[model samples]
Target: METLSLLADGFSVALTPSNLFLAVVGCILGTVIGALPGLGPSNGVAILIPLAFSLGLDATAALVLMTAVYYGAMYGGRISSILLNIPGDEPALMTTLDGYPMAKAGRASDALVLSGVASFVGAFLATIGLILLAPMLARIAFLFGPAEYFALYLLAFSTLGGIASNNQAKAAIAACIGLGISMIGLDNNTGIARLTMGELHLMDGVDFLVAIVGLFAVTEVFVFIESHGKNSALGVKLGKITIPVKDILRCKWTMLRSTFIGFIAGVLPGAGASLGSFMAYSAEKSLVRDNSQFGKGDVRGVAAPEAGNNAAAGGALVPMLTLGVPGSGTTAVLLALLMTLNITPGPTLFTDRPDVVWGLIASLLIANVVLLLLNVPMVRLFVHILSVPPWVLLPGVTMISFVGIFSLSGSTFDLLLMIGFGAMGFFLRKLDVPTVPIILGILLGNNMEDSLRRAMVISGGEWTYLFSSGIAIGLWVAAVLGFVAPMFLRGKIRKPQAITD
Candidate 1:
């Protein structure tokens, strides 16, 4: 009841004409990008942040718009997965295991509608989870001190590198690179440049937008070009978009189970949409009546993965908003936007700025509705995005990144730096090292360092300060377990669909 009252208050702000309009626009744009190969939610959200700032809207409005885009992209990713056998992003990969087969069997409309409805159900439930759980989580975080916070951040870094990638060594290296990059600017403790190399531009450290633009948007362009541009997607004739009432009834349990599974995965420190969706698909495959049809046009396959991934997307926001720890790459970008806007997200965020927190929650619900409406009836139009030639799409994306990054700093040097990171990103992506943990490293690196310094100062440089408190010791144990447990879980989990094209 208390949550309901607060949510009603949130609706008052979210329903303002301007805010509603932004939500609609974000959904449309997100769908367009999600339909396109190589442009996932993270890329879509990252590139749009700079433009969102230029819109002159207040921070709440901008966050609402960006988060709406995130949800829309999750909803839209299924379009290409079902129609073209191409996942729009990594999280959508599991959809293709059965979605494309359903399309091939002349059930394209069914596949799209089922996935669309599942996405809605998942996001709706996850938002409720967010409403109930975020405050509790934030309250718990209030007890953390500098030492506890450092250990917590270390746990985040460890889990990200340990689990998000197949090879922990590569993930660690990527994180180290990002941490090293974060140290390029002057050391606040000593008032001396550490790795600036005397370049004035390096004194400020790399802008998060520049890194995100280069790593996701620019690297994606290069990857698309390497694949010899876009090819034609398989066409499946559309029937009525509506699912039969019988089918909906049958899927009730699948949707509910996947929602819970996905939400739990999303709330974990490093598990994200991709993992959630994959786990849900695996569970559905095991429990469904027709296990024989698990990957061969199984509607449950489409329904479960779509629901789980969308739910996970919402769940991921819990840590980002309440604890200032992003569980995935997309949320990492959102965190960067908050920092850029001088909005520090933590326990105090909800208490200090209830409007932003509640308003965002309300807007996310509205965006889910918008995405469902857009996807169900107009999916045929979205599928047409596959027909767009790569030459046209790639250039537009590249131009957008270049223009946005330059606008942020007004420096050609930043452009060069972006290109440099683009090259590094391209090469690193070739190794499948997972660039997300690197961004996480960069985002949390300074804070982690500051916490360490603060704890040491309080302890008179005694190294024992690192383990001064029970919470701090617990966090250290968790960090070590985060790194060690993955080795045991690696091959035990079902492999996700790795389909790209």
Candidate 2:
């Protein structure tokens, strides 16, 4: 009953004229960004962060806009997957398995509509789950001490590498890089400059907003330049957009099951939508007696992954909101946004900032409905986004990054630093290094350090004190298992080839 009351209060905030307008704009922009292959939700949100700040949106308003974009991008990823056999992001990779085949079979419209519905189902149900689960999880988190928190942060870093990168070693290197960068500012305890290297601006440390823009937004511009701004897709032609009711009914159970699976996967720190999509599709395949049609245009194939990944997207928010651990790479980005807003997300967040927490949850519910309604009729509009030439789009993105970053601190040095990070990110991508872990490390390093220091101080510097509590030991064990499980899981998962026809 209290949850319901809070949700009602959240709806009041979400329904405000300005907030609703931002949500609509964010959804449309997110869909367009999602339709463009390779941009993904992280980049979309990163690019828009400056705009949110420039507009001086309050905490609740800003969060609402970004989370709406997050959900919208999840819906939009399927557009490219179905039409061009290209994934809009990592999580959408599975959608191409069956979505493109359906398009090739002259069911492009059906595929788009069905996938949209499935996305709606997954996201909607997942939001409901978040409402029920996050509070309980937050309550549980209230029991964590410094040692347990330190162990939990370690677990996040450990598990993150497995799902975020193909090679754990590369992920570790990225994390070290992030930790090194995070150490640039003055030490909070002693007020001593650590990595300033004599530059005054360095004393405050590198702003995460700058790094995020450089790594996620500006790096894409360089990547586009390297690719010579080419659009080579032989796009699919859409017929009349129509809902496939029969197919929706056929896949009802699949959507429900995939939602459950994806939500669980999303809640697990570091196991994100990519795993959720894969697990949902693989599970559906295994459950079916006649599974030969899975990669060859089966409607169930389209529904499972669409539902699964979207659910995972919602699920990823739980840990970010309740425990300050991002469940996915995108949620890591969102975590940065929260910290920048001077809002610390943890168990106290519910009591201290009920408006922000419940308001975000309410906005998500609205965004899901808004996305479902907008996606079907605007299918043609979003599909046209795929046709936008990179030459036209790349410059706009570059301008936004430049303007947005400058608006934040009005610092030319930060701009240069952003470009430097962009170049570094470009090289890192070339080296098959994941940037998400680096961001995660940077985001959590200070907190992790503080936790460790506090734990040691409390335990009189005894190392065994790290393992003194059951929660601490459990987290340590989970960290070890989280790091190792992905290696074996990756080998067992069969990746379906995208249809290139």
Candidate 3:
């Protein structure tokens, strides 16, 4: 009942005329962004952050808009996957395995509608799970001391590399790079300049938003430009859009099962949507009898991944909102946004600012419905995005990143720093190294350093105090397993491959 009352209050906030309009606009824009190849939820949210700031939205409104884009991107990824056999992002990779085959078989409309429904089921249920679980989890913060927090942050870093990266070594290297970057500027404790390199702007430290835009949005532009729009053509022909009720009914069980699997995966630190998609598809394949049609035009294949990834997207929110630990790359971006707004997320967040928590949650529910309605009618429009030339699209995205960053900071140095980060990201990508860990390291490095210092101060320089509590010890154990476990899990998990034209 208490949750219900709070949720009602959240609904009251979300239903305002301006907030509702933002939700709608965000959904439409997010879908378009997702439909374009290569821009996933992380980049989508990051690219729009400056716009949010320039518009001067309050905390709740900005959160609602960005999260709406997050959900919308999850839904829109399937468009390119089904139509062009090109995944808009990594999580949508599985959608291509079956979605492309279905399109090849001339059931493109069926596949699109079914995937949309599956995405809806997964996202809606996951949001409900967030509402029920996040508050309960927030209470766990009360048990955390400086030692425990340090351990927890360590766990995040360890697991993020293990789960999110193809190679733990490379992920660790990226994390080290991020941590090194975070150590720049003046030391918080001593008030002494450290890595400023004689630049005055370095005193305030690197701006989180600038780094995010550079690493995600600007890097995407460089990558796309390098590719020269080789895969921009749309070969699939769409007939009249039709709702495939029977197919949806057949996949209802698949959607529900995948949603549960995905939500759990997403809640785990660093697992994110890619793992959720893989797990759901693999589980369905194992559970079904005579699983011969998985890579073919199987509706269950479309349903499982679309549902799983979207649910995982929602589940990623659980840690970010309740624990201040992001469950996915996109949530990391959202966390930066929150911190920039001076809104600290954790246990007190629920009590001190029920409006932001509940309002964001309620807005997610609204966004899910809006995406469903918007996606169906606008299928033709989103599919047309595939026809957009890279020459036009690439420059537009680049402009947004540059203009938005400049408008936010009004610093020529920040712009130069952003381009530098973009170059770094491009090189890292060329080497197949993951950048998410780098972002995570930068986001958490300072806080982790503070927690360790505080723990040392409290324990009078006693090293053993770090392991004084069960929570701390457990976190350490989890950190080790999170790093090592992925090595074994990677082999067992079936990797998805894109279909060629």
Highest TM-score among the candidates is held by which one?
A: 3
Alpha-carbon deviation at 85 in model 1, angstroms: 0.4
Candidate 3 collision pairs: none
TM-scores of the candidates in the order shown: 0.97, 0.97, 0.98
**Which lDDT tens digits does candidate 2 get at residues 1-501?**
999999999999999999999899888888888878768888888878887888889999999999988898999999999898889877898999999889999999999999999999999999999999999999999999999999998888888786656788898899889888988889977889998989998998998889988998888888888988654454557899888999999999999999999999899988888888988999999998889999999999999999999999999999999999998889988998899789999999998999999999999999998999888877988887888777777788888889999998999999999999999999999898989888888898888888989999998999899999898899999998877877888776433333354
Estimate the TM-score for candidate 3: 0.98
CA lDDT, every prediction?
0.86, 0.89, 0.89
10 residues in a row with least lDDT, candidate 3: 492-501
Which regions in candidate 1 have their CA more than 4 angstroms from the true location?
230-236, 494-497
lDDT of 3: 0.89
Q: For residues 337-417, could you state the per-residue lDDT of candidate 3 as single tens digits?
A: 898788998888998999999999999999999999988866887888778877788788889998989999899999999
Q: What's the lDDT for residue 294 in model 3?
A: 89
